[model samples]
Target: MNIENKIDELISLINYHNEKYYNQDAPEISDAEYDNLMKELIKLEEENPNLKRVDSPSNRVGGKALDKFDQIVHKIPMLSLSNAYSGQDLKDFDKRVRDMAGSDVEYVVEFKIDGLSVGITYNDGEFEKGATRGNGVVGEDISQNLMTVKSIPLRIKEDNEIVVRGEVYISKENFQKINEQQENLGLALYANPRNLAAGSLRQLDPKLTAKRPLDIFVFNLEYGQNLKFESHSESLEFLSDLGFSVSPSYKVFKSIDDVIEHIEYWTENRGNLDFEIDGMVIKVNNLKQRETMGYTAKSPRWAIAYKFPAEKKKTKILDIIVEVGRTGTITPTAVLEPVRLAGTSVSRATLHNEDYIREKDIRINDTVLVQKAGDIIPQVIEVVKEERNGEEIGFNMPNNCPVCFEPTVRLEGEAAVKCINMSCPAQIRRGIIHFVSRDAMNIDGLGESIITLLLNEKIIEDVSDLYSIKKEDVINLERMGDKSANNLIKSIKKSKENDLWRLINGLGIKFVGVKGAKILAKNFKDIDEIMNASEEELVNLEEFGGTMANSVVEFFKEDKNINVIEKLKKASVNTKTIEDKNSNVPKIFEGMKIVLTGTLPTLKRNDAKEMIEARGAKATSSVSKSTTFVLAGEEAGSKLTKANELGIKVVDEATFIELSSLSSKEEVESKLLL
Candidate 1:
């Protein structure tokens, strides 16, 4: 066959199969076959650049960075929920419903996704826009990124304008893979799937987002044609019929008992699924009843989320080990008989305090009951005293640090032990890992194995050594090649440009997180200034606690740390620049954390985030107490409840725009004044 014909055949074949596999979930060709064909096409395209179409099969791999995030105003106000944390909470909600609406209320119970909320708009059966739930009223548009999700339909069935709400999440497998990549790259791994999803979705590069296996489940119809479903369950079915991946674990409950039972069932049995569920969402199933119920200033009167008790399981403690953390915390890890829990096998649990160990009587070779502390981290709930043999030994934190072999000590009212060793191998390893983490420097291809290889090979020791690596040196290593080396070196070089917060984070200083790092970096321009800062100086910083201040003080006091910083400077790693911090006028969210959910009536999603950032505040992608406000538009899901529970201020779209606008107007005035 002629080369021209071969190229056309390859492109046509790949396109056909991509649609079949990604869109249809029916692969006419195996992944290997698909990969081989794609490889051939890529090679061909590389050889003949003119033949490469802008919308070529290879372009589907993803594209360059987004110029800006568009702002979207949700059509509906995604309202918050009054949560029922316990059985009584659920019962109380039921009682309130019965008292108000009087006993005949129907509710639809759904698994509350521990994920990011997104809004997708379909106009005339074509995908129009997708946005993050930015301060509920406004969101950042991520339509291009959202389109890459295989489960999300590029086109919906209905021709009229249709808006759908969904929870965009990374599956457990994808989360793990992403984490592993982060670990390999020498970047900090996200604590959980929710974070991974948020981080992945917000990535400036759509190609990176596309590579992540993100899935969205359409659960609500915010607007548009023929979505006249009377109940939440019915709406879900209608959405499913429209080629949307609707979460199927919903149950229609007449009485509150059924709601309670459904929550119990999932709490005990969510391990079977590929995703994670933090709690159950119960919404009034009747459309008329829901419309009648309406919404409060913050939450919807028609809907309530019944959170599951955090997952916990009983297992035998096989051993107890005191490991030294990078920051010199001597933490106690309970090596337990492996038990399946919370969608993964748990073999260890963290015993936060010696007092905790004493109170719970955590011991080596003892039976113990552990609980997932917050549907995320595992902790020992209590000792299984009845099953424990007399031979079971109680654990005491060590005298010497596990890594540097220095003396370890615990302070009054403090649960953890500290090792003052800055050069401790464990700390070094963890610090290097953290330095390369996504939230930190985000150095890809720097995982533990390669770090170990570098360490073993004596190619480099500290993070600064990363800069010293030659491509030939990297390619010479086993499994490392010309491409891998080039990519890794490029990634490492790219990391130097990540903002001050990332550098602070990458430093692996105790008690200095992304938020704290930013504050410190802002206060003290460079590493030397931070190191010179006294404990009281650090303590005086806004929101800094004495314990945290002391930790920071101690971290800097170490000799090895000073050396590392010097080496870092020598390596030319940029650390002092506060990225995008040049707003002449400040917005309410300038440096304020914000969470967006539901549908916005106006504005594109990215535009909303950019607006928030244009003023002085940092636009965070998730909801937490640190978050100053939640801009809720229409159909805000779980995050609405999370904001309420965390006591973060919740605002409607109007309020959001008004606050954001105030900042802009102020900025205009400030610019004039300047």
Candidate 2:
């Protein structure tokens, strides 16, 4: 592509990725890839200033502020840092600092946390406001969401009006957990921790933000009216002493060589940390030196960031094969010569789909670049087409399913080809595995190995067969003991008594997950009711989209599915809501709209929602003028904030429990209104 076309394309692509990363919490490309694009665009713009668009994404630090929250105009702008990509750049920076300060300036090097930047202000030892770094000068007020992050202290030790800057992030472990939950719900996975943290903090409901494991590291004491410190490290120490989580290990260096050494050390050890760090921040330690060094229009001249290189390797594509998932989608895998990447030996990489392969012109015997996406899944980057010496052969997708030999089909406007055969063995095996997964039926002692063994022995042909497996049949399998067999049988039986939503989720219905199953179960009394419900009826319910509704209706429409349901019924599995066994209990809070906030004393937030839902009250996520009351718990956040502002009645958890225990709607109303 020519320079102008490439610049335009990069602008469009970066804007799309910015929306994906900041607003949607899903990114199609890796951060390094996005940064390279930005760098190329910037280079082109610098070379040809007339070609730059007035509204180019390169001009912005983040996505536009969301309108769901109040806007906060920053008292002091949150400036970006100029970056130094190599040792020479660092040396140049050190020389500039020395020239400006007229001395050998000490520098503090700290990890540049990969997360959303925010400015938090405190008044008289209490947190007053928290805002994101939206366009640097203006930001969205996210005080409630910030409060949900446990690492941010609501009340500091010092009684002064102060402003601090920090990075809000999610831990790698929590990011994995959240992605797992998303996969179970059949939703698109988040790309990385930074995106997830930003999306979580921007949620309109503080309750939703509370569910995300977000943390913060205070690095800059922007405006401390009553506090005075000589150096950046001293300010960090004061912030840490006031219970603010500070950045991880940092050091003072007198030479640029030492700074480069620290950067190299972290480049090699970045994977060791629980949180993600894209680079290291090198700053002039002395506050006076920083003031003298001063600022540019958008970034500070006193500080520089050294970014790590993208990790990639070149390998040969040995072959491409397809695997059928539980949902019947055929995914292509690239078998390759084993190569080490990100501390793992990767022999296979994801091709994504047929479209991706065709777009990249990937062929057999072709050399291709590869990288570990998110430091987890391996993926092919691009083909080295020049290396092909007329030996590479173009690939074609199979016309039939690999496992069952059933005719495969690609739906219109969709990229994935799927096997529609209900009884495909691959589908059955994967579905059974999912059914016993912890997020589904949660059957203990029933793992993939035992299921595979049972399938091979013809003891179970499908999920329904699992419920009917006898102890004698299980005990006969290899590595099966009497005690193990009994435990397995007991576990299977216990699963039969799980809430109807579990059974619904365990059915492997496409697009209908834990949340969908709960909505279905609450609306319909039993499996039969759900099976008979029309698509319109399903779609009419809250949280049910048109596609999800159609999937549910189509899944139950199949005679084979009906047969499985019959088999499950014959095995005495409870297909109805088990929690609502007491039909005699009155829906005392019927038609009432209640909002729950903060951590309850003895009940989880979800459990509390269910309890209120059982009593015929709607458990709304956000507070508004229409809300009946706010159930305030310890550390009540933004919901309580808005509720009080709107003159809505707010009650303690004790009062909430007392009102819930009331037997009649009249008594409940009287107890609250009186």
Candidate 3:
């Protein structure tokens, strides 16, 4: 074969492997083998620049950084599917389709992945952009983040522009791992994998998105410039051939009975899959038939989704227990009589707190309704009062910390009863763990086990002691070799130079997160300055409220805290805030009150608010007549309705983005300033 022909063949082979690995989650070749192919492709492209293709698989790693996503107007609207709650609903949908398109009807059935729906656009087989299905007609651009999803292809061999729709999801395994990390870091647990997946997809940083184990399964060909396919199933096959990840278990059935059978099979066996699937999607297979049946403004009449209800089971609460968290907050848990739920044998479930138990009148020895929340966490849905016996005992929260025996107090506005001891063993261990975490000081070689060892061995009492550890001290510990010890010492030394916000966040002051810490650090110059500040001064910062300000003041007032700071200061740890060079940028949206609703095209809800705040605008939560503007996106829902009723000016996402970039607010102030 000629050099040009060889390059083409290599491209085809590489694309196939890319689809097999990224999309299908099955690799036919080893990593080394794939690397060798990529190596050859790069070498050939380098030697013969004329033969190189812009959309080649060689460019899959990454591309240019996107400051913000640009909006994309989908050529064909990505309509949602109407839902079918029961088997009868499915039959009715089939009848409607058959009545409109004749009895020669066929249906394509596939799993409806519980994830965010994204529209991926390809220009002449080159991967172009990926967007969320914002409002069917317009979607937020997330091309860079989508490119980070290994399951998504950067380029395809098919030389035609096409738009395909897929669900971007995280596997249950990955979700569990992420939650575990969050739990270890003293962070709030994610509600479910679906929410996590959506949040990960909308992340402003593609680098962060890449760390999430996101996958995609293409299910529809929304639009194809020059492509022709007779049926939906045919189009799926074509998409697969073109190096796209198509549905793993798609089947075409001529009879409604077959479609119903398929849905039933999946409903019973859904737990077997690695990813979460909320329901089964049944679509009319014939393209011409679909066109004839048409749409219903928001949803397609040609298709309907069957949603599976949450799985529930009954179990007895054997005992109630309280566990002290890192921050000393006590959480109540029910030790349940082992019951099988959603494929896993759950032995225990969280009762939340004393208030939850009291509200439900839950007692030990009472039978309760148990469910897998989001098919992940085991939680008590409610108490089964009818099954409760007189022998069941009422429960109450302890007056003292379970671990430290310290007097516990509940904050005025919060439900949690907290232990106030600064030197509580559990708190110290948790604090050290958080301090060395990725988002904090980021001591690479330090983990919970190592920190625990250090604590138990009396090598460290507080976070500052981490900076004082010698290599010899760690080398003698379990699993620590010479190289590991040296690395740990190096990482510890490196952490002293972290930004002041990290140190503030690592301190775990109540209500002071990364954002709040950054605000405090930026407002004040150093740790000593923050410690010396009054509640009034702390509350003056935008991110700080009265409660938060009080918490900071309280945290700093402790002798132990001051001692830790002194130790850190003596260790030469960085305590000074690094000033943002752009801090002096003109406040373009000054005095403007903006309310954002729904999901914006390219920006996450928080990202949009941050941008608005950066531009000297106040992003409020509610929409009223006083709202300078309501930035609306797809599924604007009640907020949009309220904005319209209140005579608040509403702008689409594109207009909002454009307005945000305006250098001056003079025109806006004249038109809509409050």
Candidate 4:
């Protein structure tokens, strides 16, 4: 076959597999096989550039990086939906619809996906452009970024020009993965999935957007040239038939009462879904009825969204306490009467700081409304002042550190009250915890509990003392056996050989995280070099601001910190750069299917998954016959047993690390095969 024909065939095959994996959730080919096909197509396209098709699957990897997105005026307005917060509000909407369109109206209810709205246009069965829903009429063109979403088909079976509206979103699982990556890099966490999805889609560089996990659920057939549909449900069916991922829970209801009942059911059960939905949309099923109902000034009269109320509970604030952090920042926490919230028991909530408490007038022995902020963090929504009694007492920030009794001071223009004593036991304890975190020195078997125990037992004084811990000392501790103690000592020894960047992050330097540490490690040869660097020099480095530079200089200037560093150096901990800073990670596990089970000693499940995926491995949730390896950790359960029964290779964290260190695919294969 000709090169062009071969390319076409490859594109078709890849697209098919993509749809199967992304949309259908059933894949016929292995990830490696799919990757090989893509590689071949890319090679052919590079050789014969002019012959490359616009609808090729290779476009999903992304194209040229753009400095800015062009603005596009939407042909049809993307109207917002009127919301119904209560059953009465929904009933009122139903009554209004019945008054205009008659009592025989059928309603189609679908999940109101909490995501960014976008419109994709197709011409002659090929994707033409995609734009965001901005101001209802105008939007930024994000065609290149939209093209990277695999669930979005590059070509469809439809011949006529059409515009489809979809909600571009990140799944809850992928959102957690993204946050894990952010935490590993020491970046600020995104508030929620909707904000993250919007930020990702609006990224200036398509390559950056391509790296994010994005999916779309096409809901409305916005425009279809020379096409007619009898009902809204029919149009959705047509779109689904064209390989578009649509709402799986859309149902037609005969009565408004039934619609409200379904909405109530979903309102309580929506947490079971993989994606997020803020509400349920009730739309007139009949297209003719929709036309009769017509559009309002801002939203459609025929459709309304029944929004779920933020789950809140009234609980008594038992007490307010403060805790010292690694940075010596004292944080106020409210101990609450245990209440079930967002499917979990909520016993404690962050009060943020002293100013927050003063502003909210939070008190001990007072009733307060509590809710999960972004459905993740428990927070005090408001105080139930009406229920306050004479016994309730307003809480005050501590004048001194609770643990070390050092005088606390609030700095100018800062909300935090901090204890400046570097040798404070609370600060040291928290600092040691930070030092041994997965993103820092990555010492396994030294969890927060273990660190606390070691501190209270006086087995270790600070982060530097961890390297000197003996297995015999650990074995004598309560609940620690010979094997556990041995593992702990080994992990500490292993961490001493870690790269300079990890050591820098492990230092818990003010305003210097993993990403900043990497930048410093890349620019400077050793920790001493960084310590000696001028603030002006640091400020000039990429991504470093004046505040961060000052913080770095200030942290290194401390005599206590210098003492700790000297101790670490004496213990022979690696403090110098060892590898090329800009080198790409080898895809040692490429084409491998790995399953992770139980509690990993050093890495969280998501962290381990992210690490493997970075090195080109598919980390599956379940063990299967095709699984290349089962990475079993402490307390491994059914998955590990199943892997053994299937005769699949079972590896521990140490073995996994050995496999990851292999430089070539051949080396990885040989290791796995053995």
TM-score per prediction, in order, is: 0.67, 0.53, 0.64, 0.54
Candidate 2, TM-score vs. the true structure? 0.53
**lDDT, candidate 2, 1-674, per-residue tens:** 78899998998888789778855899899989998998888889889999966446554332333446666778897766777778898889888889998776899999899888899999888778888875455566887778767677666778889999999998888887888898898667786787788888877767678778888998899899867899999999898899888987989888888889889988888888888887899999999888998987546889998977666788999998889989888999999998856534579999988899999999888899998876678999999988999989888888999999999999999999899888899899999999998768899888778888989899899889988888999897876899999999999999988889989999989998888988888888899999999999999999899999999999988998899999999998989876555356689989999999864544668778877887988889899888998886534545765776688887755567788889999998888786
lDDT of 4 by residue, 147-210 (tens): 9998898889988999999999998889878888988986667767887888888888888889
Give the runs in model 2 whose Cα sits over 4 Å from its true position: 1-106, 110-278, 287-310, 476-483, 580-674
Best by TM-score: 1
Better of 1 and 4 by lDDT: 4
Kindly give the stretch of ten consecutive residues in candidate 4 with the minimal lDDT sum. 598-607
Residue 107 error, candidate 3, Å = 9.4
Question: How well does candidate 1 score on lDDT at residue 406?
Answer: 80
- lDDT tens per residue, model 3, 1-674: 89889888999998898778865899999999998988888889889989877667655544455677677888887766667888898889888888899999988889888889999988866788888887567788888788878777777887778888999888888887888898898777777777888998877777678778888899998888877889999899888988777988898899988888888888788878998888898888989888898876456888998988777788999999988777888899999999856544589999888788889999999999998876788888899899866899999899888888988898898888888787888898898888888777878989888898999999998898888899888899987999999889989888888889889999888888877887888888899899999999988888689999999999998899899988999999999987764467568788889998887666668678877887887889898777888887865756766776677777777767667666677855654443
lDDT ranking from best to worst?
4, 2, 3, 1
lDDT of 1 by residue, 552-651 (tens): 8887777877787788788888867564554565554445566777555465565676666666566667887678677765456677767767877777
Runs with alpha carbons beyond 4 Å of true place in candidate 1: 1-68, 145-159, 168-216, 225-230, 233-237, 240-245, 273-275, 389-393, 404-674
TM-score of 4: 0.54
User: Which scores higher on TM-score, 2 or 3?
Assistant: 3
Residue pairs clashing in model 2 are: none
